[model samples]
Target: MGYIAFTIGFIVFFFVLAFLSTTFSIPADAMLPIGGLLLLVMIIAIAAYAALS
Candidate 1:
């Protein structure tokens, strides 16, 4: 169970990192807000999944 969770989180972390790197060309200042919003969305998604399960 721990391994599964770790693997999923690892994949998601890298996926998001790659996406942000490739998709955004803005400055770090601009990216700060975007990253925060994406993090919030990710948290919400995880919370929703937990609630549904």
Candidate 2:
């Protein structure tokens, strides 16, 4: 029950942040690079977690 509530709240927060970003004048091409960087960070985090455990 607690985890479910937390998940809902986290999703709500994400959408709120996404709505706020809509007002910005960001370029579409920038997303590819940012997404790639985030993906790299995610991979590194998972690798480190696996190595530690």
Root-mean-square deviation of each candidate, in angstroms?
Answer: 3.1, 6.1
* Candidate 1, 13-49: lDDT as tens digits: 6688668767875677876777777777766766666
Structure candidate 2, residue pairs in collision: none
Reference-based TM-score of each model: 0.62, 0.51
Question: What is the lDDT of every predicted structure here?
Answer: 0.69, 0.56
Superposed by TM-score, candidate 2 places the C-alpha of residue 10 at a distance from the truth, in angstroms, of: 14
Pick the TM-score winner: 1
Error of 1 at 18 (Å): 4.3
lDDT of 1: 0.69
Q: Which ten residues in a row have the lowest lDDT in candidate 1?
A: 1-10
RMSD from true fold, candidate 1 = 3.1
